[model samples]
Target chain A: MQRATLNRMTPYAFMAPAAIVMVIALLYPLLYMVWGSFRDWNPAQTIGETEFVGFKNYITLFYDPAFRESLSVTLRFAVIVVSVEMVIGVGLALLLDRNIRGMSVLRTLFILPMMIAPVVVGLMWRYMYHPTVGTFNRWLKSIGLEGVDWLGQNALMSVIIADIWQWTPFIFILALAALQSLPRSALEAARIDGATPWQQIWHIKIPLMMPVLIVTCLLRLIDAFKVLEVILVMTEGGPGLSTEILALRISRTATEFRELGVAAAMSNYLLILLLILTAAMFAYTKIQEAREARIRAAAEEDM
Target chain B: MPTIRLDNLVKRYGAVEVLHGIDLSMEENEFTVLVGPSGCGKSTTLRMIAGLETVSDGEIYINDKPVSHLEPKERDLAMVFQDYALYPHMNVAKNMSFALRLERRPKAEIDQKVREVAEVLGLTPYLHRKPGELSGGQRQRVAMGRALTRDSATFLFDEPLSNLDAKLRGQMRAELALMRQRVHKNMIYVTHDQIEAMTLADRIVVMHGGYIQQQGTPEELFKRPVNKFVAGFLGTPPMNFLDADIVERDGTVWVTGKGFELALDGEHADAVRAHRAKQITVGIRPSDLSFDPDAANENSFELRVIVSEYIGAQSVLMCDCGGQQVVVELKSETPIPLGETLRFSVNPAGVHLFDKESENAI
Candidate 1:
């Protein structure tokens, strides 16, 4: 009886460290934020001294044009970035998925943007988009075109371009890995079946790659909704609220506006949205696994 | 149907060559099978003919037009791979009609063709299922069905039956033979099994070490093998060789070798007289030797029966002959004692003689 009890406790014992760390690092802050979202708290006041308010912060932010604009900007940014990245990344993968000289070096170069720290990426793009002296304006002026404002009138577009430049490598490496693992003989049979190169891509390559591409797109979408550092550095939600994405807005609400309740509520909304996305990805994979299991079961039953 | 020809075809990988200039002419509607051990360049030659491999040298002709430079699609050929290579995401009907759909054929016509071929292959019930949901045999049949639906002028099969179990392989082999009779297109098959070559081929091309050793009808190759390797390779319980010398024994040609002497038949005697080499190797199939204790001396061998292997009605008796091994096939009812010397006579017409050094039949 004692040994059986010990066996029952062993799994929990093994998981205890991770559980404790999650509580301290994740759950504690999350629970604290939920509690703080009900109280009109200030950074200067202790948590116990704050006067409790009921849903006023969330109700107020719902009608605020600035917050609504921030939400729309984030939605637009996430959709555009992920959609463009998927096409370009999968296109590059299909083009480079064959034997060529120095292909390894080229593939390595393609993924260099992904390995840099986010802060470093932000700083690098900030310098490259500097108004009077930047890569784009320099090249533009050199080509007999006048220098145009990069971070002033076109701040959202500039930040979006930077995010795409940095994050595209992430999707490229994943898509390339997916393309390489596909069965080769099937593709050859396609060639012999009178499938032109375009037809093979449309019918064979894309269908086989759909699963990985869907997951990759969701991962990028989730990351896009939370992006802050590059925009924070380059535009600072600036040029009259044209580039204030959700994460940047949430940070400014707590630190600059001293509205911890509204910030916590905003963070919760983002969390809920992300939870829905993650659940979707998980359910998709589960359905696929269940289908494959059914197929194998049917085959085994036939035998 | 178009006739296929490989004229001095070759394949090379960088500085190393795999196929040494293979030349073969496969007549229209003929089932030509290339049989060899692995790394013998048979599959390479077939792949080149299908335009999957770039021809390193010489020309491939289809109905007398050069096709070496053409693409696989342009050549109007279909291939069945060893792995079946069915599309995992597509249903059976979709896979069979993929070529027709790619060609933009009318939808009703495509459906009709797919249904007809699927019915022929007995895959009608699984038309809606993907390849991943099917068994290995079913996947192979789908691969076959896909090729059959195309009705291309030429069909290339690269070791298609090798992945199947023995029972299924035999069944599929018969189905393939029936399919061959129905389809009059030129079919080129590659396999390592000589039995498959002998059974299915209208013309068998035997390859070894990247070279074509011989090409002929199965009966012609079996009855008159040109060399030692061909003789030893084709038969089961392969031919046994014994060192011997040709001698003029009282005006009749006799071969004395390894604890026995045998007089040549009149037809072989004329060839033996024309040969300059005195030394020769005599080969005999195990089936050619019959247990006959009362036979005359010139046509029989004295052997020490060592062990008997009983396999149903016929038993194979491993025997000893003057320090070398010899095998004899006999009825299980033959009362042969172990460790005792006995006489097993060989059919005079079954005897084969080869030059000692060259290993070539004389």
Candidate 2:
């Protein structure tokens, strides 16, 4: 009996370090933020010295038009960026999934943007989007075309373009991997079954790749919501509140406005939105796995 | 149905050539089976006919029209893959009607056609189930059902039944033969099993090393093979080969080997006399040798039985004639004494001779 008990305890002993790390690093900070969101807290005092004001910060953010504007901007940016990136990424994957000379080198070049740091990407795009001395304006002037204001009036679009430029390769690499792993014999059978190239892609390839594509799309959506560094470096929320995303707004509320409780409340809202998305993603994968398991069981029973 | 012709077809991958010049003409509504070992280019030949592979140096003609440059869709051919290749996302009905749907046929027509094919394949009960939910045999039937709904000019099969279990393979082979009788279109099938070739093919084209060894009716190839490879490849238990020399003694020609001497008569004797080479390879099928006690030395072999495999109704006996191995198939109740010498007479008509140097039938 004692030997069996010791064997059972061995696995828990091995997992103790990770559990301790999770409680201190993750659970503690999360509880602290949730506690702070209900109080009138500031940077001048400790958490115990601040007075509790239930739902005041949340109520203020509910009616704040500036907060509402930032939320809408974040939503629009995420939706448009994810949709456009998915289309272009999957399109490029389909076009380039073939054997040719120097194809490996070309694929490596296509994914280079995804490997660079986000800060460097932001600085690089900022220089290229300069009004007069930028690459875009210089090329426009050389082609006898008028130069447009990039960062002054069109700051939101400029930041969105930069984010897309840095992130499209993430989707492209995944889509290409999915495309390459498709059944070769099935594609050959499609060709023999009188399907043209375009029909083959539309009917067979797209439907077969739907699972991987859905997961990739959800992951990109999640990342798009929390995006801050590139836009902060490029636009700095300038040209008024046009380019102020939720993450940028939350940071400004805590630092510039000196309202830590309101910032914590805003952070809770973002966290709630992300939690819903993460739950949806998790539920989708669980359902898919259950279906696959049922299918496997049915197949085995037939055998 | 349109007749397909491959005129001097060849396939090359970079610097290496896999298939040499191949010239074959398949008749309209004929079931031609390209049977060979793996890497023998049979599948490559079928893929070329299906327009899946590019023609390297020759022209493919369908009903006397050059079609090498045409796309697979334009060629109007349907194919069944070895793994069945059923779409995992689609149900049986959807998979069967994919071609018709792509062509934008009427919805009612597509539904009717799908129902008809599904009923014929006995897949009507599983019409709404995805391929992953079905058994291997059901998936195979769905693959065939998909091809049948196309109504193409030609049908290509690339080792369709090879992935099934042994018993299932036999059952599916019989079903394929039955289906072949009801639906007569230009069909080209590729497989490595000679039994499948013999049972289903109207004309069997045997290949070796990327070249066609022989093409003929089953009876013709079995009775008179053009080369030693065909003789050994097509039959069960395979043909036994022995080194021998032709000798003339007292106006009678006989092939004398290490432990046996067989007399040749009629055309065989004449062919042996006319041949310049004295040494040749003697070929004999296991079924041609029968256990006999009072046979002459010129017509029988004294073999030491080594192992006897008791299969119901028939038993295969492995024996040693001199130093070479010989397999004999006979009734299981033949009461043979294992570990002892037995005299088995050879049927004169079943004798085959090949040139030792070229391995060609003489």
Model 2 alpha-carbon miss at residue B158, Å: 0.5
Q: Give per-residue CA lDDT, model 1, range B1-362, as digits (tens).
A: 68888899889999989988898999979999999899999999999998889999989999999999998999999999999999998989899999999999999999999989988999987887889878889999999999999989999999999999999999999999999888898999999998899999999999988889889999887878888888887877778889999988788999997799999999888898887769999999899999899999999999999999998888899999999899888889988899999999999889999999998898
Tell the DockQ for candidate 2. Answer: 0.52
**Runs with alpha carbons beyond 4 Å of true place in candidate 2:** A1-16, A280-303
For all predicted structures, in order, the TM-scores are 0.92, 0.95
What fraction of the native interface does candidate 1 get right in terms of contacts?
0.70
State fnat for each of the candidate structures: 0.70, 0.72
Interface RMSD of 1: 4.5
| Tens digits of lDDT, candidate 2, B335-357 | 99999999999989899999999
Question: Could you say which candidate leads in DockQ?
Answer: 2
Mark the regions of model 1 whose C-alpha exceeds 4 Å error after superposition: A1-25, A45-54, A281-303, B305-307, B335-341
RMSD (Cα, Å) for all candidates, in order, is 3.3, 3.0
